[model samples]
Target: MIWFYERRGEHLRCEIRQQLEGDQFALVVTMPDGSERVELFEDSRILNVRSVELEKLLRSKGWDGPFARDI
Candidate 1:
């Protein structure tokens, strides 16, 4: 799954996908500057926790989304 957020015309992207090599999940974040950050999770519970935390953080910082696509 993927989500996008924007503020002042800059975009932030988040993607969740399963890794091909193992039973792990990846939460990838793409910053507005084009840099990337990755977090690996062993289970869905923690992944959901972190995902929501990031969403709240971005919203508090004045970004608007979890849009289904880039806007």
Candidate 2:
């Protein structure tokens, strides 16, 4: 299971995890950088989100793409 969150003045945080509720999965949250808030979402919402969507979300949240790529 994976959950994601964005907070003021911080990088994106994602949680990758696995759990079993009698064969179900545990909720996971991955954040390389600590955040002020973590948003909990529905299980259904975690379904089939692509990397492109992530990049778009990051951009929408003011994540500037790559650094010094052309340098």
Measured over all alpha carbons after superposition, the RMSD of each candidate to the real structure, in angstroms, is: 1.6, 7.2
lDDT tens string, model 1, 1-71?
99999999999999999999888999999998899999999998999999999999999999999899635
Instruction: Flag regions of model 2 displaced more than 4 Å.
Output: 1-9, 22-46, 50-54, 64-71
Q: Candidate 1 — number of clashing residue pairs?
A: 0
Which residue pairs clash within candidate 1? none
Candidate 2 TM-score over all chains jointly = 0.33
For candidate 2, write residues 1-71 as lDDT tens digits: 33344455444444423333343333333444543333333353452353346657766866664232232
Each model's total of backbone clashes: 0, 4
